[model samples]
Target: MDFSGAIFEGGAYFLKAKFEGGAYFLEAKFEGWAYFLEAKFEGDVNFSGAIFEGDVNFSGAIFETRGMFAHVEKIEEEVKFSGAILNRVFFEDTDLTKIRFYGTAIENAYLAGANFGNKRFIEEREAIDEERNLLQHITKALKKPGLKSILKSMFVFFAFPDNSYRKIKTKCKPISEAFRRAEDVYRNVKLSLQNEGDYETAGEFYYKEMLMRRKRTLYEIKNLKYWLFSHIYSKLCGYGEKPLRVILAAFFVILFFGTFYWLTGTVTGEGITDSSFDYYYFSVVTFTTLGFGDIHPVSFTGKLATMLEALTGAFMMALFVLVFGRKMLR
Candidate 1:
């Protein structure tokens, strides 16, 4: 189905939809929340100049030909192409603030026109270009030398370019062995741009997706000058922690509940300002797995809170056990 010259200006899409043949969204834009979740694309899909304001979920899609998202122009929210299969992809000239390529595979990709949307990345262009030149020179030098030429082609094809590096490594063992020494450079390029707030962030994510495929991890080091506020906020806001962090998270969540209690109690002077004490006490009891019925809640919201605390306690304890098991056993 040719959707070229058509505009998909809606917020909702049918779940698990299937589109065969080449579907073109060349210059078409998705202006709001959209979903192609579990949708399958069975041919070449072009999304050049398309804009995604919300989440993109092509979870079980198949791009038999190639998928081009080059010059995406704008992607305001997170992009998830997880669990999808692609033959090739182009993402040059995109504004991707946050991207995740978890569990996705691109077999053979060309990223020639791609740009990471920043100046620091622009600065690295010369160094990358120099590496490209060196690759070309080597490719020609070992051209006539039998096995050496095969090794040389591997060096040029899998070494410098950002896209097909890992795919080539997994498919071509001979080439993979020849450039084993360059693994650090490959890892560093991915690690450098792993958690950038600027354009470097997306580049790192994209590069990692290409290099490691499903086994990729995004590296994030809090920038002291920039992320000071955010780091403090996450710590204060329950994120990516277990065991004691779980306990701390419960305390903060209940703190928010206590704050709500304090503000609302002032509205009716007889209302419970005492819920503050109850919040901490409940969290503590919940953390310790106590099932006492003495200080029981009366309101329906309070009952819901009790259930939530109980569930949170169970989750935290499980997390504690799982995470600590890995550390202690290892």
Candidate 2:
């Protein structure tokens, strides 16, 4: 039954209608309310590029096989799938602002590239809260408790792919409010996965969760002391990933202080004249706090530089040791 390019000027109903073969609704336009309540599709179904100008309901409907509902251009009002059994449904590259999946069993559903636009996020949150409240009422309608619970959990887990995580991260990369929303969703998903005992997948989500938290700290929270500390920690040790960053920082510090010592001309020694090599060597010696007694600072600037460099060197060396130990242990 192909309704491709068909236009419905008023409300349309397919209530309790059963399609035993292939069904197509490509490019169909629904100008008023669209109903598919309890409709059953026994074979493949396609609804690509459909435009729903008014509310559409598929409550209690069943898709027994694969279904395509991608690239929907617009849905001016709510499109609900509550209590619908959607099997291997594809909803990619669609604006999902008005879509709701409460109480839906979406097994192996793919939602890649779907845009849950920010405008509907508040409504979506409210819907989720309402659904949570209504769960008690809906639980009484369930026939098989264990199987439904397992299938629903699996559906929730597979509805969003790992690449979807990257999409959320990229979309929320710049704005703090968007990132907060992304983080909230990410943390919820991670917790759900953990609760399901899927530790491996949960670990990946946990990493993303921490990364979002770090980004939120850097961009949204605006805590100065923590920001500064985290910034320095990342640069010096790459958050404990790249030890070479510490080495580079140490080299830069040595060069800067060495130049300062040479310019001040404050070091006096028996053989160390106004030579660049002598100044650099003396700088390294002072930084390491190895006072050989042959070369000493003759001025206040040199002494101050020596003290500062020594403290910096001590801190850097300790940090390197700690980071290196962590890496080796890991």
Candidate 3:
């Protein structure tokens, strides 16, 4: 439901409906699913500290400005951002992507089917950024009795990434072992993403340490978020249409040779002798280097034909091998 262009201003509100700036959702919230597909914006759009019970589908949604999502609590359901275009995306210490909240529409976080930025969650978080005035915010949040419970749950995600289990082993005892165990899981998750060409995520494990040591967000603490984005964007989108082009080139070569070979084997003489078994077989053997001597060329054109067939064979094989290898690596 788009109406923001007709309403909304530069402040926050607890609205009962949607936000649409011509179609941008800027900084607004609904009580349930938030939909703002096909919206255009001129500045940053923030969806900070909002909640949704249903899937967050932003497929094909275009944001001319950066998109900010943070502090969304208890959204234990699938969160989809497929095909949503944006200038920048921010996920600040968001635990929902890593921790599945119980109840509501989500029975389990896995069942929630959360897909964070190309299915690569847990990017280099611990770096200088997470530490962003760590003492300031943690101390501030710690003072609020209301935030204590949530922060305790949030610690399951924040503190456990580095096999901190041993370093903090005696620091926390017995039941707190779950915290260490969770840290191991977090590290494994980060490792898996790193293995799957998600270095930004794997890097987060190290970055998180950077933050914990220094106490801040990577950008705020170290200004490395810019570098992180440069690396992540390239890996995610990669080289577009190169693979597609190789496929097209292959088809073109196949079409050219298939037609040429088919025509070459056609009966061009008055009575047609040796059909095309000899010609096609000759082409195959010539291309494959299996030069059996039973088939001898009697004419100038026939002997010349053998040489051309051999050349085509080499070219096609080389081209196909290159194309196949590129696809496999991609």
Candidate 4:
């Protein structure tokens, strides 16, 4: 049944309607509420460029084959699809901020270019409660079969990159349950974006996923060793992104040991020099493992400090090489 370009000025109802063949509603406009309760489409259906000035309900509807509703320009109010089954639906280039998908089965859905709106921090308790309710609705929708695939397809649409880092850290930080699921969602999105050759965006999502993992490890896993390692690896070197951090760390280590040597008077040069410069120079040489015969450590503390500095230098140098190599390769 073709209703292409048809205009329904009043409310439209197709309750329990069955379409055995292709159903077309291209560019249709609904001025009032539109309901398709329990309707079934057995063949391909198209509602591309449709406009609904009022709320649209598709509760209990079923699309057995492929369907398209791409480029829906306007939906005046919320669009409900509770208990609906959609097969291979296309919602590209649509705004879905007010779309409700409670108990909706979205199989092989394509949501590229769709806008899920920005998520802001809700400070008010009432607003937070509302957001929680909304989250619950979305969670219920995600309970469909093949949940991973559905999440992968819809992630890029809903996870818009509007100051995402700050949003995730501040206002839009997911609840514990959502945070766990977000790890998988971000990972899948990253992989998908990478496959599509969007490396820049993929890298951003990868970082977000890593941040989520870090939080999970710190709060949920409660492993101090792993958490410490992750913290150092990430902040000290930005997961191999910032090579300068290595140099900075090395500088601090040199300064600390140099001060120690000066205060303790444990470093000696070939001459009777007890200058700060001499101590600093000795510290640098020792850190670099350059055991110059001109200068040596005199005390046990100096020897221990020298060994520690040498180990630190080697480790930092190795890390710098690895990080630099990774950046260069990328």
Candidate 5:
């Protein structure tokens, strides 16, 4: 059943169809809804370089052998496979950013290098800059009011420089909708990866999911406190998935308090000393609540700084242990 480079302008239904041999849909374009509900594929199936612009479904379908869908460029909506029997399906090097998986169970699935539209802060900033530049170009071209200028603006709008970093298509829909869908997909994929015993990948997806959620809350929901908490959680320990971040946070806290103690000046048996190392040593003692009593703060501000440093240090130590233990236990 060859459908190489075929174009489906409308609905493509193959309900309960049985393909006894290999099925090929290489470079096919699905411009509308595609359905293969309860279909049976007895041999290998390929859909490399396909473009799905609408809804797609393979619910209850059975793939007796391997199936592949690599290098899919654009998928505008969900490509559901709930209740499908995917024996060995491969989606490597595919962009699944807009797709959603619901109630699906995957076995021997290969999803290496798949894009899920999970952008970090740096990537998001780059995207924003790109958008700003594009808008500026478009505005300048439109001000001329000529066919050539209009064409150039259109070209610039559509002919975005293709790169690995461009995962989400910002023009497809609203940013909030994209974020919501991304959050949902990340959660589902995280759960799927956890079920497959890939904790490290699952943790990465979990971080992405939280990032999307945080953005949604901040921009869409306009929840200031919630966003602040989420931001702090990400910075402190990456939602408990990165123990190294906790260690760094603790080190920074100690350094900050040490500098504060040095600037404010403390007391020793030999009176006040301007040495930075002595203040740092006293800072460490205060942070750990050692309380040797050989060194004390003379001014009220210095005493307050020591008290706050002790409290902060204790909290940071506990947080580090909690984060590290969570990672180790998992």
Candidate 6:
């Protein structure tokens, strides 16, 4: 069934609807609530370039074959997909921050350029209260028995439906089910991007997934070890996704050991000198394992520090290579 360019001014209710063949909704506009609860699609379903201006729901819907829901400019309200079965769906080049995927089943979904929740949760949640309040007021007024009250309600809605009914603000509260659901969605998206061979984007999603887990473990689960491990991983190398972090880490390690050697004093051909550059040079040489023998550590603490610097340098060099290579290849 083709619904291309159709306008759902009031709403698009397809509750429990069944489509035996391909279902198309290309470039359709939904100006109000859109309900597809428990709907079934036997073949490919397309909704490319659709516009949703209000609440959207696809709870418990099933797509038996490939589906497309791409190229949407924006969605004014949070989209509910709780318990939906999305099989081989494409959501490329779409903003996905407002999409709630709680309990949703997904397989082989393409989400390239689809944004998951970031710091915009608070910003988005705050922006929608005006429209929501206006709508609630209108709904409550229209429920009265008198026709005059209904007209007055409609007038009030037209006049005070502020914020242009365009966008809504949304933020996921901490230690809530929404937070956990978002974490799950991030994990699924990360795996899906990985399967698509988009490793760089996959790495970003992986970072978000790990971040969500870290926050949950720290705040809700209260697991100190897990939180510490995750925090260290992020601080050290951004979970293997950031080459710059690795580079910075190496720089700091070199500087730290160089300062240590300078303070402890190293022996040279002319005997120990207080020159900072000399100790720094010795530190670099020892770190790279390029022992020049022109300068050596006489103190036991200095010698032990050299060995430790060598091990750290090797590890940092290896890490930099790995992360840099991944970034370049991706």
Model 1, 1-330: lDDT tens digits are 766556566675747877777778887767666676777777778988877777767766677777888778777887776666666666544543355454566555444333332211101111222123223322232232231212211112221213333343343333333333233334433343332222233233233233322111111222344345434433432222223565576566656644543444321223224457754554466455695544555566666665776786677567657645643442
Q: Residue-wise lDDT of candidate 6 within 1-330, one digit each (tens)?
A: 999999999988899999999999999989999999999999999989999999999989999997898888779997887778877777766777688766676666555445543313221122222212222322332233331112211111011112321342222342333345445655665565566565666687677667767765664555799889899889988988887887787778888888887765644545346668877787788778888788887878877888898898888888889878878877
Q: Is candidate 4 or candidate 6 better by lDDT?
A: 4
Instruction: State the RMSD for candidate 4.
Output: 7.9
Local distance difference test, each candidate? 0.48, 0.67, 0.40, 0.69, 0.68, 0.67
Off by over 4 Å in 1: 116-330
- In order, how many clashes per candidate? 1, 0, 21, 0, 0, 8
Q: In angstroms, how far off is 24's CA in candidate 3?
A: 21
lDDT of 2 by residue, 5-99 (tens): 99999999999999999999999999999999999999998989999999999988999998899998789998888778888887767776678
TM-score of each: 0.37, 0.48, 0.28, 0.66, 0.56, 0.54
Q: Against the true structure, whose lDDT is highest?
A: 4
lDDT of 5: 0.68
State model 3's lDDT. Answer: 0.40
Residue range 225-316, candidate 5, lDDT tens digits: 99999999999999888889988887788888888877656545453466788777888888888988878888788878888888988888
TM-score of candidate 2 against the unseen true structure: 0.48
Q: Higher TM-score: candidate 2 or 5?
A: 5
Greater TM-score among 1 and 2 belongs to 2
lDDT at residue 140 of model 2 (Cα atoms) = 22
Q: Where does the lowest 10-residue lDDT sum fall in candidate 4?
A: 121-130
What is the Cα-based TM-score of model 1?
A: 0.37
- Candidate 1 local distance difference test against the native: 0.48
Least lDDT summed over 10 consecutive residues: which range in candidate 5?
A: 151-160
